[model samples]
Target: MYTSQQPAIAVDGQNRIHIVWSSYLPIGNALYNIFYRMRNSNGLWGPIETLSVFPNSYHNYNPRVAIDSEGNVHVVWEAYLANEYYPHIAHRVKTNRGWSEVVVLQSSYRRENPSCAVDKFNNLQVVVTTNEIGPSYDIVRFVRTPEGNWEGPDTVVHFNTGSRYFPEIVATPDGNLHLFRRDFGHYTNYCYRIYYKRYKILNYVILE
Candidate 1:
């Protein structure tokens, strides 16, 4: 059997809903992979499709889904590949034609729990947690332009003695990006507290 976890959903302007999640299988070279499905405006659900490529003894989880202004579907997830010990954030986009190839964003540090959103101008924005520092993880953001150019893995939130993780991102129609995350061991002695930050977009630049 298989187990599913951390499902995310997004709706397009046409009212079609897309959903993605990670599925785990006990016996296979591919232990975990991302899967997706869609519900049409008529409320009929489409067949489930596998989103992660290669499988290849890698595990993927925490898939986040978003729909851009042009009706393209975007998914980002935490992937642990077969040949890599460190985790990476992987992204894929589906347009009217088909799904694009998987884009793996690997960094020197461990990254995971990606949250993604599409801005008013159709730029894809993503946020993930990085554990490069000693004590805890910090949240970082990445922006993918409509023309497929990528920018920024900038650290948006940091903690010296604790960890901030499991970030969630939202893009408003007014060109504002709102970020929410959970913190541990910082304010209340091992308790997780909710933290929020916002960014404004001007000419494709994210401003504090």
Candidate 2:
């Protein structure tokens, strides 16, 4: 039975499709752990793998997956770690042997609702919301370089310090990153407002 919801699928250059989602398994009196799954080339799905290993019971949701040119799988989601809530971004590369271990890309502050994509150079770019410090809101980006290392800390996209949620990232064919987010300020009377920004990878400028 499928326990996890919000499944996102992506295919790499070699026609390798990667599927990722968050699953909750009952432990005892209302306890569950978020798990992930994948389908290999032979059209057979591997066993369900647990993503979070927290002791205390916590909820994990909103999982998104993206694959790079080299068949590296990037997964991002909202997970409850310890006593805090934050967005977690992880990557697994397909090697000649098997799938590598999941590597965390971001693990600081209270980030939620993450989205990711890979640029033309096969670099992974992730976007998420953070509200750990104060009442302000911010969108952060994490890029995985070709050297198999994550680029420093998160780079802020917008510094509104307002309410931002439901972020979506997509790398355009022109090598530019397109980010879509919800701005609550514009829709004070309503629920939320949709905001779009195009970021140039080379220049690192957000365009209109």
Give candidates' CA RMSD values in order: 1.9, 3.8
Question: Pick by lDDT: which candidate is best?
Answer: 1
Clashing residue pairs, backbone N/CA/C < 3 A, model 2? 87-111, 137-161
Which stretches in model 2 have alpha-carbon errors above 4 Å? Answer: 26-34, 38-49, 53-59, 83-91, 105-108, 132-134, 159-161, 186-190, 203-208
Query: What residue runs in model 1 are displaced by over 4 Å at the alpha carbon?
Result: 26-28, 55-57, 133-135
Q: After TM-score superposition, what is the CA distance of residue 191 in candidate 2 from its true location, in Å?
A: 3.8
Q: Which residue pairs come into collision in candidate 1?
A: none
> All candidates' lDDT scores?
0.86, 0.65
- What TM-scores do the predictions have? 0.92, 0.76
Q: Per-residue error at 88 for model 1, in Å?
A: 0.4
Q: Tell me the tens digit of each residue's lDDT in model 1 across 106-168.
A: 777899889999888888999898986556788888889999988878778876878888899
Instruction: Give lDDT: candidate 1, residue 16.
Output: 89
